[model samples]
Target chain A: MTQQNPQYKKVVEYIMSEIENGSLKEGSRLPSEKELCEMFSLSRQTIRHATGELEKNRVITRVKGSGTYVGDQSRPRRKPRYRSVAVMLTYVNSYIFPPVLQGISNTLNNKGYSVSVSFTNNDIEREKRTLEQILSSDKVDALIAEPSKSALPNPNMNYYRMLEKRGIPVLFINSSYPKLDMPCIRLDDEGIGYEAVKYLISQGHRDIAAVFHCEDLQGIRRYAGFDRALRENGIVLDPEKVIWLDTAGVSDLDPLMDYITKRISTATAVFAYNDEVACQLIRGFNRKGIRVPDDISVIGVDDAEAARTAEPPLTTFPHPKAELGIMAAQKIIEQIENPLMKRDHLFLPEIIVRDSVKNLNKEEK
Target chain B: MTQQNPQYKKVVEYIMSEIENGSLKEGSRLPSEKELCEMFSLSRQTIRHATGELEKNRVITRVKGSGTYVGDQSRPRRKPRYRSVAVMLTYVNSYIFPPVLQGISNTLNNKGYSVSVSFTNNDIEREKRTLEQILSSDKVDALIAEPSKSALPNPNMNYYRMLEKRGIPVLFINSSYPKLDMPCIRLDDEGIGYEAVKYLISQGHRDIAAVFHCEDLQGIRRYAGFDRALRENGIVLDPEKVIWLDTAGVSDLDPLMDYITKRISTATAVFAYNDEVACQLIRGFNRKGIRVPDDISVIGVDDAEAARTAEPPLTTFPHPKAELGIMAAQKIIEQIENPLMKRDHLFLPEIIVRDSVKNLNKEEK
Candidate 1:
């Protein structure tokens, strides 16, 4: 084991002493394996073994594709003044949020800002409570938020206005409440909807059915774009062809699946609000003996893992989940540095074609 | 609309004035809808309309099966000194974390304590950084943590020790580090494993294969229990039939599925670490033209949503997800109130038999 190896112990002790002596500061890049090998006159394997031990001991962090950095415990014992950022999101564990959060955490951590996270579970009441706590905590220096039910008129507007009045820089992500007038970093959700439908049209699919989540502004905007796409194509917007499901409806998809099947029975293609819905629809169709891209073609937004792993692999618009988060962190920090900073970033829609969308033009030709 | 109705407005105005004058406190439960009708001499329909408006306006919250409570903005403008709690978990969004967080947040919010959450993504480095932040923040009164990679030797133990030395109460949820000597509220994972295997054996499955997550103490303990059950049944524990997967293996299961399939080829039943693994195996089997329960039986722990929704619904051991979080919050509060208090809690397992397990005795007869 590396623990028992004399040469590895020497390397570990050298790094430990450097960290203790303030020669190697927290977050600073450590010597590369090649350089370490040269310095210690040891094999590359020994260097790796020592570094691995250091990483496990929390003395260094090895970021993939990035060099190793001096890890935790190097901070000065005396309390240092550092700006803290508060991030509140609808959800933080699964799907897109994980990468988004990873991006935000990484960016902010690199900038030496302490980041604290809170989850609202997409509930307005939880959002209200979280806001109230943030307002009173006196710890947070800035805020990055994904508004709860942004499409709905939020009663928590006063709390946000209060935050503004207090001169706290708050940047919105994914979705922003209209009443807030805050700077936001999000994907071009409407463009995503427009592009997805246009791609379906390119594939010669007309009678396109749509399923939209109606709670957040992103979903609402996407629906708006979907409507515009149909109108531009001189296609009548059939009310029956469009299905609106809220967060609750989305969570328990079993009862909704029957409704969805009935709604899309006459359609040759479907545009789902997200990969989750798209995957679920595909699964539901499988059970009913309907094959994806064979019986009915489907497309979705957000190139989630489900989209890639779904039976037929969905052709979907990619949501810049992590990139958006990184930009949000950078923008929020800039806003913090300069209170006058006012900027909004919108990631353009990019379609990742897989097997879900069928080419009706091939049959026509 | 409720806004235009005079009777609804009257009920709203009454509640608003009561809140403004401090008659109704934050978190204080409101009278039931029936009582409100009696008080206002309004119809039940009108009362419902009024309360719905109140809920939307953030003046009140209506928890299902629970009474409505006075909502945000009821607190005095002057910052009241409230004891704050910090929650650190492995993941906060998907699977079991949502309900667990809900329980913790609800309990803490009800007690007028401020709660801040952080995610570690089950990484020791993130845990170290988060703990360092918590230590430096000096805001947290107590901490409720789910230790990251609890089965492995953790390097962040010193930070936890520092928190203890600072007289800040820390209670662990899900899993606790063995070296910490900290109080934890978690499911009896070992018993769950033993019970799941016993249930499978009761259904007459002799050749059993097991897949275990080896990163956390819960998984390790569960493995121990599984081994005991096999030994008790006089069945030789086949190393080839046992697969020990880490967090990375759990995340990207495609490559591992082949190995798993080959390992469990001779086994009549398989016990997965959790519902996720079980559902993945079922899906993997489906692709290989293998049917669940009909071809091979499967059992898993954590009655996650996927368990219920999996093709053939899974037979799983129930995890006290939210209840554990609630108990953790409650215990941490108790510890905060009395620093000398030290208690540990373990939730016993119960199996939810769905369609996944098949009784071989029926075929034998």
Candidate 2:
């Protein structure tokens, strides 16, 4: 018991005793890496590797920006215990939050881990500040964040980097900053765009207009998909029919309405970035006495719950939003428990058709 | 210097020295009430009174179940500095999380304190467990929670009582359990229900159906309001038209759908419990080939984002979900900074009209 794996045994025994004595406690952060390295008189890398093994054993978790912590292994060893995890998003009062949260909640809850949530309001400053606070506070054991648009400068990359350096686990959902070392859970936005446009094309709509909120990496990918579909279908991308709104600068609908009205001449069918933006477009079009599908067909991404109840319904691409949340939570947990585990997850999006798009053949000639 | 008010002067000097010497960090949990009493060799009640004065002076915050912590005061006085404060929630991915969060963030940020959040996924066990974790972690200075309905069945009431006994401040949102001695930030659910029904009557609807999701104090109030509206209008409540879905037990939509489809009749209008339930009902009706507003008018409570984008566009009661978050955060902060300050807040709900509810006059006879 003391010879071959003495160092390993010592670290394991220390954590186990803490758990048994209820000293480390569940959802509590362990000592810093520097402190552990010093206490063990071992190299920082060696200390981390040992901690990594413990993490893989599900005895502890490393929250990014936050330190490692004892995992939720309350019972005597049997199966790997699911450790506590947290998710941070910009807004939760949308159709997307419940399902996505449900996905994460159900998955973590089943694994015997609790999930905590935070909202950033899509403000980069707020997002960075909240992340820093979470990290410094050492409250959560792991984090899954839907990062603000990559195009929008987030001044908090250093904090995220610090978490990575500490071997804490973090996963990005919906969008991720490419250069970051963190894993991400996202849909094939370009593929979704291509599928959506192809669906509309199959319905015999030649002239399609696409509307998107700009300055977001996700929005750009979606636009790329829309462009690719049009290109593959032998339709040139018409600059006039594409409406791009600077959502980061102005979060109002007036400019968006004016942009859509101007494109009414050449666009008989429209593809929107997301359900919220699509709904706004519909409301604007309706105000001008325009009818959906009959006058102009509209499509959106994110088969949000609102899409189903929107006037005439919204035909759009459905992504595994909640599934993404679940996967992200699972992945971050994996990273926390198994520091050597390195994998990327890509979720696929589905196209859901309803009344928002019209069949050209049904229209009166 | 230690003349007339020797005890008060000594306490003030001790706190100031700790602050200036950087021994008391911002967000750090203060010494326990019993420990402070012992250190000062004073009665526990005297220590409590002194702490109360400090709290009023914005020197510290008492988070129930957590501990007393340095307040978010940026004063250059001869004292230690605290960095920020945070408020936690159970979930943020709903129609209600945003505005309330916005209000909290705005208020807290303006006051130079940072706000952090956490969610418990509505599990009472998790809620209780997380509270303990958050308390020991010493993360935020204060907390504002909309406790789960199941909290009543557990020892959480006693736990919170102990917290209050120790001088920590907590504020409940949306749901109030009188057994807990805490302030609550809620909405006039009954008034909202009555107003929603009154609006439908004004629109010339008679045979209106009311669909409610069961359990919870808020739901009860909303139902009472709905019944009051019908009673005032001399419209008898039809048991057949009142569809109640046990949302507490069943988290999925299948049961809700089954309940809605089985009870839907020749009612001209339907009043749903909330936006989430209303959207589901509309989707169920659409699946059955029934056109909303044309076949049956529908109204929902909670002007959730989904309601605005539902297929026919839901008409709903506009409850300030975000405003509730903000008010709850503010009240909790106030309580934390001033233990003697006691107050309760309740917000009002409004009506937002869209396409889901149709005017009877617009129907073709």
Candidate 3:
């Protein structure tokens, strides 16, 4: 079953060279179909055929959801993999992850590092399993992870310690475990929160409501910042105006928002944890006969794609999504090289003024 | 390290009983932290302690991302596992998948079957890998997959055939490979397409444009139906007015919609593939100063959550999301019990009238 076709043979040779040169490590995933097609200028069929041949030859293995990996699945490779990095994220295709993943993959791929990604769905149990797999696999030299439910007490701390003990450097992205002495690359959530609320306050809105995800460290930090801004302005924080949520609560905000509507009816403005929540709140508000920036003002963090197309566009703060991912990849590689190295970064937020916030002072004047 | 606490002992005993009763099998994942907490009526700390003890004793193994399994990872369990099922999907948390997953899990769990899920991200390479892993695992008694790019010339057909040879019953949901002889539960995409276009025509629309995903079979079939409706109504098809897209193209519709504006300028109505696409097109058209249902009526398939929330609300055909999921689960279980059983269903489409489509006939009169 040997192929005489030059294109097929070329692909096979390219893959073999990639493995031989340590560009594709044993147990590491190969580049995606789109990437392979772009690299070789080959059709999908030729690429699939080449991979099929490679799989039969025991040089590559394909797993359904995780993608294709180097080495054979029939035998587990005990040797430490070369130039391989594993990324554990909440999601790979949704929200702000695409850019972040692209940033991480593009940076690592250019440096000849093989990257394999796993999604935790922001579930602690799933995160624990992912960490255990990476620890036992011996396929990863380093890891970059976004802590799942960072505000909650996570039991996966032991797994992180085990990775550290094994000399496999790990870096946190987006969020980190407060107990773990690990470096993290993330946006300044607290600063973003402060800036969003302060901007809203500058518009002469005294009564403000906030929707926050209590499970995420980012959400908690942002809420803290919101509190600080209100305190500094000599405004008393109304307990009823603040809504604490988790992952599940964010999806169905209608019932909660309806109940919150009456409680926060006196509030003139609402600060959401992120653009997604902000947009949903606006919709939930609209459904209840309340209009944004007219009946009430709204502001949010993370100038995500949703912010631009939102009903009145959203007044938001930049999240530094891709930049954070690139930095995390660079820093993780740095840590892998120098085990003693420690670096943490917090990208400050920049205001992206949109139409969601209303200036009550303008009307008063 | 002995746990003297009765709560911890009781939790441990319950897990042991589950395994003993065959509800939990070797190489199958254990219930999540929330599930355990609910079942035992115990604190998370106690549940963690019991699981820790279980892990230490080799009663279970925890892997990050994938979750905790009921067997040791040090050795591969080659024997066929009991009452375990694996679901392969494009996504678990986004768009229409959550309801589908909930339906499947709820139904399966009620029958004492443990379910594990994997996401393909609609990438063929990832799907291929997922199939290979399931084939090698020997843990899953049955498999349910939402085919990745069902319209594409898939090379993973051999993997499906291999699953069949191994006596593993496979079921498809949402979409299925046309080449594969498998039971699938999905919506009547073609009928929905025809119905949508026909509805627009009934509202006195003659020059209708279409937007569809070329990679998905649903899109292709819908386009076919769209074509049929046009021909039957003595309306000639305009190739320039039809826009075909893939996954990546759907994200940023601005540039494409900008170009398409000129070509589809004469089009009085637009039939979108789904509500997501329909909502984006409405926004795109709105940006281009074209008001939906006023300047041009629009109809979409899938009365998804987006349809109702869309600016003017969307006129769409319904997609039996959760119902399809529930039916797929029941059929898959039937197939697993009787490998020779064959069942395929196509849920009929029903139009949900909304504000997006205008009555052009009234204007003409």
Candidate 4:
């Protein structure tokens, strides 16, 4: 029995040798189980056992109607030597994510690593589940997450801490848990806010409303920046001019629009947190027969493609989005390649001036 | 030596068995390797060997600062079983791909299989490389592809035949190769074209200009549909009205816009092949001070999200997007679970009305 088991191992090794030597090209049918039985002079069960091992290793594909063929076998045979990296985000369907993914994919692919993407749909439970899955799978080498607004006080934070304790690197983008030691790739929310307001102020607008979706850290920083910019320019912050829209637990835009309409009369120029809000507001204004720039000047953050193409064209803060992607990928790669490296990396945002904002004085001239 | 190996295996096996049996939960740290070696009365090398196997299988994660802990073992212990489904497309970052991916993700997630994504980037060499990768990897049990617009003399068609001969299931989505016997998720391009024109005509349109981007199967179908709709309504198809914008070897919208402008007159209504083209037209029209619907009503196909958010909002055909994802996923899952299943599936498209098109009577009133 001892000799028999070793003999089966030898047979399996022989087949692998043939495959490795290029004698068995992909899609080339393998010898039948009966033929293998005859050639190896072994019991059918033993040959089956040997073939089963080959199948488990993904060295061959077994089709019932057809015969087994040599598998691609091109995927690196060397097991991943580094810790796994996990990227958690809300959605993968927009322009924002593809470039991020492209940057990550290109970097990771070059480093001979594989990346797995998981979507949270902004659900706390799903986010928790996804993190748990990543930690448990041990498949992820590192983590690049855009956390749900409810991350703090959420149990998932504990789990994230656990990963940290285990020496797994976790990075946040467009979101942050500042208390956590993990590094983040965040937009200059404060800068964007300041820039939008400064531009409006420079255009000789005394009354400006900054509209923002509030829920997380980014929102807080942006609101702070807006306040700072207004104060720096000696414009007293009007509580009414600061409109905070509740995006928490709200996914639709109708109620938000209603709120904006009630507040629109007081401000001559409006600044929005992101392009989506800017576009929505523009649509709402158009519905009211209020022409953009001519009736009310507007500016928005995030130089998303929508901003540039919206009716009057949106004037937006040109965020270095691709750079953000590159930075995150680079950070993760650096951490992976040099586990001892420790430094917090921050990237700057660029302002892209488009047509959405109405320069009231310029238009009059 | 055999006894020592088995003894070391037993120690590691005991810990793993606790994990598998739920006695040890994920994130729970384990005993030191030295402790384990001592407990098994085996050398450190044997203990290391066994623990290494456990780690490779993703059953545990070892951290530098922290000790080893139980890893996510929720994924099936076996390597993912091979399936017949493959997705071949140009650039994974395009606007149309996400909804399709969401559909595929939801459908396939419901089933027990994983889908492999491959990108061709519109290059024939990359497309061929992707195919070679897919075929050799033995990862895809079947295929769903939107072949490159320029992949002619049908090199891909023959590859599909090769997969078919090997009894692998194949399906096509968004685009089709009619000569191939594969299931396809296709839009009723003819109906969409006819409907777009018919809607414009119903709004009291007379002089109409149609713009097409390319001469691929999709472009051909849309053009034919436009012509058929015009002919059915007893409007003479003016060769001049059908302007084929040279999109070949071009990726930008500026040249196309210039071409349209030079040929444009007082055409009351304009129909475009897709929302992207419609958006470019809106921008071009804005530059020329030509009012939409007030001067020329515009209709587009593929009611992507951007369509609804475009300046005036675009009226378009809702491609069978979600269904395409579901069908592709279902087809792949079926092929994976039951390798004997045959291919050939088709879907339908629906119209979504929005604000981009203006009613001439409404304007008159």
Model 2: per-residue Cα lDDT over A1-365, one tens digit each: 01134465466657666765789887788888788878888777777777878776677877778677777344343233336676888672267877888898898888778887888766555676777886787756667887864533344687777766755567888888754766677888778888889988988898998776544667667777787788778786664466554443124454336534765556788888888778877887888888887888889878888898999899887868777777776776666765433456666666787899889866646
- Distance from true location, Cα of A43 in model 3, Å: 67
TM-score of model 1 vs. true structure: 0.41
Q: Count the backbone clashes (under 3 Å) in each candidate.
A: 1, 26, 16, 27
Backbone clash pairs in model 2 (N, Cα, C under 3 Å; residues 3+ apart or in different chains), count: 26
Docking class of 1: incorrect
Q: Candidate 3 at residue A127, lDDT?
A: 85
**lDDT tens per residue, model 2, B24-47:** 877787888888878888877777
Worst 10 residues of 3 chain A by lDDT: A1-10
Predicted complexes: DockQ each: 0.01, 0.01, 0.01, 0.01
lDDT for each residue of candidate 4 in A1-365, tens digit (9 for 90 to 100): 01122556656767776765689887788899899989989998888888787776566768879878787344433233553567787662255777777777677777777778888765455787898887787867688888764312233578888886776778787777654656677777777788778888878787888665543556656766786787778776554455544342123344345445655577888887677778778888888787787778888776778787888898887656667777788777665543333345554565666666666677567
lDDT tens per residue, model 1, B238-348: 655766665655654565566568767999999998888888888888888878898899998888899999989999988888887788888887677545345678998
**Residue B200 displacement in candidate 1 (angstroms):** 0.6
* Candidate-wise lDDT, in order: 0.79, 0.69, 0.79, 0.67
Q: Which whole-number lDDT from 0 to 100 does residue A289 have in model 4? A: 84
Error of 3 at B307 (Å): 46
What does the lDDT come to for candidate 1?
0.79
Candidate 1 collision pairs: A93-B93
RMSD of 1: 25.0
Candidate 3, residue A50: the lDDT equals 87
Off by over 4 Å in 4: A1-83, A150-152, A248-251, A363-365, B1-365
Report the Cα lDDT for residue B160, model 2. 67
B1-365 per-residue lDDT for model 4 (tens digits): 01122555576658766865789897888889889878877888988887787776566777889788887434433232463356777652266888887898777766655667778765444666777777677666677777664212234567767777765667677666655645566677667787788888888886788776442456656766776677678775544455543233123455346445655565888898788788778878888888776777788887767788887888888776777788778766654444323345444465677776777766677
